[model samples]
Target: MRLPIITFGMALAFCAVHLFVGRLRWLDRTPRSRWLSFAGGVAVGYVFLHILPELGAHASTFEDATGLDAPLAEGLVYTLSLVGLALFYGLERALALSRGERMAREGRDRPHHPVFWLHIAASALLVALIAYLLNHREDPSAAGLALYFAAMVLHFVTADFGTRADHPEIYDARGRWVLAAATLGGWALGLLVELPELAIGCLFAFVGGGIVLLVLKEELPEDRKSFFLPFLGGALLYAALVLGETYLAAA
Candidate 1:
């Protein structure tokens, strides 16, 4: 039980990277694009290799338990994913539209967009959900905890860069703190209660879908500028590592 408390420290440290890493001169000089691509690769790889399989099994079980036909359950899962994608991308579109309106009305640029804050709020919820899942997992071994921390911390850093880049000041000032609080909030919830298997499966689908849309939309900018080698390298490498670990654990 006491070991779980370290998760709070881990959450703080994870959030701290968002808060302070921008201030480092060396990081400033580094080519951020490739790093972000690799980190995104790592995250996307983890989802496909690890989380998706679990989500699939859970989804199947959920359908069985609920007495829903396979097709219906599958369709609903797909729709949930599409809904998640639409929400985030739709928010981006709304932001663009709002920007156009502001420019026409004011005859100049607006420094900030409201949609960015919405994204921040949405992302905070995601962070919390993820933290809750991590803390409430069936096994809480040292090795498992470490690996989960390593993977998720990178995922958070990469996913967060997109948000911070969009509105550095806003994300840095208030968004970071909000996310930190959300992490602790999730942890507290995990300590207090557990979600039913059905709810877990649904949350997994929602978040997985959101992550797929979020990472791709953020990584793929206009002009198609990206590092494919690093991207593939990160994905393949992480996939191999995760698979190897899973096999060893099973054996």
Candidate 2:
């Protein structure tokens, strides 16, 4: 009973971040906020420390469900991870090219309506998967759930900033709503339907890959002028927390 209540609260929190992210004007800046960079670092740390390791641990379960050869079954999750990363990378590149072309033609740097919708659809799907996973976590401990929630909330801040930057007017008007709805809808679906372990593993792997690409894209772009020290601090802090949690669980 308490777990459902807590999960529902987390779901609402996820939706709130998307719906209200535009109001955070401080995050809009030329040189990117150190805090956003720090958020990205924590997100990356969670992917590396938690998500990826869990995917590996689920490899055998995936193998049993799929009944593929050992090698293929073991590799499939990582392959899906790469596919997710590449898919988002391709989307980002497409948006960049479209924005450049639009800038050259109309003196506007944003994607057209079609491209914007396409991007939003993809983003919403990712958000939905994230929300769904919140209800289907491998480790449902209070500490684990809290860590996951904190990392994702911070990640969503960075993600919302990027989306809002890309299409400010449209995102505020419609994109946020779409994502917020997706978050809640995903949670509702999770409450009603439980997927197989293999399916959950696949979802986690794909999301992990997407997160890595999204976080790195923001940090690695020189034009953003991202802060390094804050990023490092965030990564180290999150890594310590995760390690401590693991140690305690083991004990």
Candidate 3:
């Protein structure tokens, strides 16, 4: 009962981030906000320091549940992570091409209407999956949940900014509401359905890969003029927190 309530609270919080991100005018800048870069760095830290390691730890559990050959099972989660990264990379490339074509043909710089919806739908799915995982985390402790929530809140902030930039005309009008609803829907789904540990591991792996790709994509673009110092500060701060949590747990 307590866990569900906590998870629900987290889900609402996640939804709020999407719904209210537009109010963060500081993030609306020609050169990307240093804070957004910092958010990206925190997300990257979470993925590399926590999510990937958890996937590795769960590999054996995945094998035990599925009874696959040890070698195959061991490599499978990592492979799925790669697949997740590739999937998002491909999506970004497609969006970029659409934007370029539309700009050249119509003198507008956004994806086709259909492509814009597709991008929003995909983004909604990603947010939903993250919300679902809030209930089924590897570390369900208060500290663990706090770490996950902080990283994700920041990640969503960065994501919302990027998405809005891509489809400025439609994003504020419709896309944010879609993402917010997806977050709550995911939490409700989590309450109703308990997936197997193996399935959970796979989902986590895929999301981890996607996070890595998404964060890097936003930060690495030359035109964005991302701030390196804030990014580094964010990464280091998150890494230290994660390490401290690990040490306390082990002790």
Model 2, backbone clash pairs (residues 3+ apart or across chains), number: 0
Instruction: Flag regions of model 2 displaced more than 4 Å.
Output: none
User: Cα-based RMSD of the predictions, in order?
Assistant: 2.9, 1.3, 1.4
Candidate 3 — worst ten consecutive residues by lDDT sum? 1-10
All candidates' TM-scores? 0.85, 0.96, 0.95
Question: Model 2 residue 37 lDDT?
Answer: 87
Q: Tell me how many clashing residue pairs each candidate has.
A: 0, 0, 0
Task: Give the best candidate by TM-score.
Answer: 2
Give RMSD (Å) of candidate 3 vs. truth: 1.4
Clashing pairs in 2: none
Tens digit per residue, CA lDDT, model 2, 62-107: 7888788777876988888888899889888888988999999999
Instruction: Please report how far candidate 2 places residue 242 from its true position, in Å.
Output: 0.7
User: Model 3, which residues run further than 4 Å from truth?
Assistant: none
